[model samples]
Target chain A: MPDARSTPVTAAILVIGDEILSGRTKDKNIGYIAEYLTSSGIDLREVRVVPDVAEEIVAAVNALRARYTYLFTTGGIGPTHDDITADCVAQALGVGIDVDPRARAMLLERIKEADLNEARLRMARIPFGAELIENAVSKAPGFMIENVIVMAGVPAIMQSMLDAVAPRLRTGARVTAETIEAGNLPEGGYASDLALVAKAHPGVSIGSYPSMTPAGFRNQIVVRGRDGEAVAAARAAVEALVARLHAARG
Target chain B: MPDARSTPVTAAILVIGDEILSGRTKDKNIGYIAEYLTSSGIDLREVRVVPDVAEEIVAAVNALRARYTYLFTTGGIGPTHDDITADCVAQALGVGIDVDPRARAMLLERIKEADLNEARLRMARIPFGAELIENAVSKAPGFMIENVIVMAGVPAIMQSMLDAVAPRLRTGARVTAETIEAGNLPEGGYASDLALVAKAHPGVSIGSYPSMTPAGFRNQIVVRGRDGEAVAAARAAVEALVARLHAARG
Candidate 1:
């Protein structure tokens, strides 16, 4: 259990890969990262997916890090020429990047002496002054420096890295969520009324999710809040709206 | 099968919702749309998620529509105050927006006459010169103007709307795919050699998917090409690399 009163945490995700932009690979990372950060009580403000270009990576890294409390980057950290995250992070932070002795030693533990070639060595490069974030699944560790955490693009490795860093991250009050399923009712039919409910309860967030059914359109109005009482109050209002809708239909 | 030969089809997805930015909602629409476009031979070039703010929506809509062959927006099409996709699209195209008679007629057919209030009427609005893309599950149809298509963010509705519009879209030559799985090998260990292999196969796209098991990390390299022979050639090179990895380990 990490500290929940972590002075209001905020995070941004930078997804790196041309595959994402080209729609060759639909990114699964943004959703996973967003959910993880939110559950940890860290506000996830924005997500940007840049190509494999070094300049774009550096620019995005610099901009996101400057704006958010923590910046997490996924992808572009492989052993190929395209895998330039380590170097880009160094350039972004204006620090020297090289194969760190510590990282190299970790790599040595995993690979056979005969297999310790140039390609394998590429994974050992770390930005100066960065602390290694462990990858439990693989020996190739991710790194964190100046509030920016760089993890692998692959979901499994990224998850392992996130689990490793979770203990170290600061947290805040977790939000409580409640959903009221307004089945077969169009969201527009209740917009003004829901807006009033939202206004009446300033602390709670009211979101409507519309779903289409065999019969007609349906909406699930979700009320979220940090305070339990406030969330309950908002839920009650949503229930009232649903009851009214049923009555009118009847 | 649609004719995907004459015109090179392209699409950009605009995800709209404050919940997405606030991390309250994790967007799943992009992946679904990406997969859909690829199978249809429509190249999805860019994706941008903007907050439900009209200005941002207007700007993103204009930019993406100009750059891509088709622009698809998901979310903010519901009947809430935040659901302002219609108004924003109208503004983006510099056209008059109102409760169109056709859309209103559709809503009237779906909803009880007694419950058809002003709030419900909001869902009937469409931008001028826009053609309706039917939401088969729900009566409310998505609208398309020029190359811009405004559909619901809800996955089901979005999918339905896509099915409706997909038939009408001009597509291109379908890209074929091939895969070679290199079991229990870190991508770094094969990076340089694989880079050469990739360089040699210029027409094919070689993507490395790293998977983690209880034993170790495994990389699955997928080669995509327009020509079947090129795809097979790339797969042969990948198989050779996998064999080399095994021999090296022995």
Candidate 2:
């Protein structure tokens, strides 16, 4: 709790859409959000994908925002009838929502009058006391109420909106990563030795990712730590284990 | 609902772990589950990833299982202290759980006596009325109780278990997909025209995906339907629309 490794900023992602659930659309937002959050030094700790149901959306928003330092949501902010993220966010916060002048002004720039019907009007509503997160490509803006940042779910639009919002987030000390590729060893074979290395380096995180290569299944042990010295120490231990594994194989 | 679509078998995926949320792990499970369920003719209508918390997992299981035909969970069934999915699943169903004779018999095949301690005993706990799903790579068998299929979080193991389970599931009529790539067009520009096409194809689902190619941004229109003939008709209309778009650009 001493903030020695910088203030740890934890965040969550809420993806709302029926398309994702139906398998009609494969999600590309989670990866982009994860990469963006990591590079910005915010630890993204949780993500939930719920349907357009107002009750479910409200529940997820309340739960995630309470737990994480920042809650980022994508999807359900479109002009379609199924798009209900705006109203859901408003209800979750127990605040009145209407077409904010700032939001309406922004939408009017890209959308024509006839195109902007009552259905389109739904996208302009923001919770009271919320700050609009600018959408660069499309005029419809995402809004941030307290710790929750509500953004569009479309990958292109979401990326554009994230570009406009990421600069404003509070960042912690960046966690650096190093990987050691251990060839052709099943995770079970190295499980005991790896466990010992993990216990020794308490400050570092060691993850075993078994990947299928052209040669066959190769396990890559990744060591991550805020302290470079601890990470190096863990990496050395992993290398020694890998050498022993090779000798045993021979 | 009539049995016209072959009984509409529905399934939900519960992704467990803090790593996925923290962006340390980009989840490959949901996509694999979605694709696998669709291929097996099971309608995967929902997916949720909860943390290593008991209350959250119990609530999700209760809600999703009641609404869907089947529920599949990945992650948290490991030997570590954070691994608590098996116990939570048992608690959710209000069933008596201990190391089932069969489960213990299977685990004993691969793991040694010293390795299978009190901590590892947690993995062997199977709820009442549960049946084991075979894990070809490792001895830790996945369990199926009621409508929920508890599989490993690792992609390879999950895939193998899914392959084993697919044959046993009651399948509906297989849904078919068709794509019409619209080269270099923005989604908003063709919004009105696409709406007309969507209206025409009432039975088919038409989605416009905006993508970046070597030439720049392009829109790929996809048509999905249960009827092959209906999907082809929708695809033809989309192709015409894309052609008109190209001519207009020229």
Candidate 3:
């Protein structure tokens, strides 16, 4: 393969579930996968949460898989009828799906053959030519077909599957980040100067985040880029700006 | 207006910020909005999180606006250079955007005239022919153009803006949800039966969510529908199934 650091790797996450849309379940997988990908040198560009409708799942899988280097999907891969992600992926890729021997073996590790009824066998269904991703928690393996990686909705299983698949992925240069505490200095006081510094530094992305606290507003400015030197330069500029504003107020 | 009970109002949330995508910030809005809309008689059907890039924001705005009854957006409305959501929404709607007198007046409530520099004025920019959504927490306002409701990224301000705009929105019948705990009941034991219950109740959507607990798996079956009777019936069926499984285990 080409040098991992020289290429750009991007990813998108598709969360498939009605529970999330109904607010019956709060999604914990998206943020976990995003942080995991970022630390692994892959940039997560977008995320979409769609209901467990087959058509919607297929469309999202096709769209995201085509747009990014990899598409990671969580949810809708269980034993119930609502778990249609595998069928949707098969339909999206125009491939056949059936109970894979490898996946069935994984399921057998946790379940007896007599108890593996039709509903349980559903967990063994994988699209043709897809590789099974180990779920160390549940033993119901996730799968990867082409650029799409399908994982379980349960956080522990999803994390285990991600760890199982991470080593095989192509990664770009890891992005470095620096956070500057803007504290009580309002963004309005420094936005103009920050814009100039941002314009001067083309590659780095700088963001100002403000949150409400019991005391007042607490603000943080983060600078990030694949080039460590560029990130450091932007951080210094932001630090200088904050110090100058603080001195003026004093 | 048509009878609110007879109509189905659907919405999509478009979160615009690179901080969320980079995993620097975990989103607190999607779940809050989902629950808010669910209780307010609006169905939140989809959610998309995109970066601060202009084209991506514009495309997402246009696409979601066309597909849903209401498209709600958060983030990128601040004074900094990355705050380009207003411009992108204007471009998406093919409308002109500039500093609105009404919004500037709102800002003047919190900012003195001498301190209202160019950067602060950026927050006052609003698209033409749009109504302002008040932000009680911060004086800078969000706006609504057609079906799209733009709000601030901060949780407190976004909640305020959502409350301000909720009165004007056309809502459908409220969806009622019922959750049944399936303690120690493996999904494989009841997936088939639950599928039957789901099929029998056509209008209701049923989902089984299993999460790993310190001791074992804790699963919940959620039944949701706009019709109270349907939701209750599905919930009863799920409850009976769980009880039957528990008895068999004993």
TM-score of each candidate structure, all chains considered together: 0.86, 0.77, 0.98
TM-score of chain B of 3: 0.98
Q: Who wins the lDDT comparison? A: 3
Give one digit per residue, the lDDT tens place, for model 3 in B46-116: 99999999999999998899999999999999999999999999999999999999999999999999999
lDDT of 3 by residue, A135-242 (tens): 999899999999999999988899999999998888999989899999999899999999999999998999999988998988899999998999999999999999
Among the numbered candidates, top TM-score falls to 3
Distance (Å) between predicted and true CA of A177, model 2?
3.0
For model 1, residues B1-250, the per-residue Cα lDDT tens digits are: 6555545687788888867866666787887887788777777765667766788789889988997899999988777766889999999899999989999888877778787777777788999899999987667789899999999887887889999988887778877777688887667777888889989988877777675576666677878766678889989998999899889889
Candidate 2 has an lDDT of 0.80
| Backbone clashes counted, model 3 | 0
- Sort order, lDDT high to low: 3, 1, 2
C-alpha positional error of residue B85 in candidate 2 after TM-score superposition, expressed in Å: 4.6
What is the lDDT for B148 in model 3?
A: 96
DockQ of 2: 0.28
What lDDT score goes with residue A83 in model 1?
83
Interface RMSD measured for model 2: 4.1
Model 1 - which docking category? acceptable
Q: What lDDT tens digits, residue by residue, belong to model 2 across residues A52-152?
A: 67898999899889989899999878654456788999999999999888998898898787667665666788999999999887778998889989998
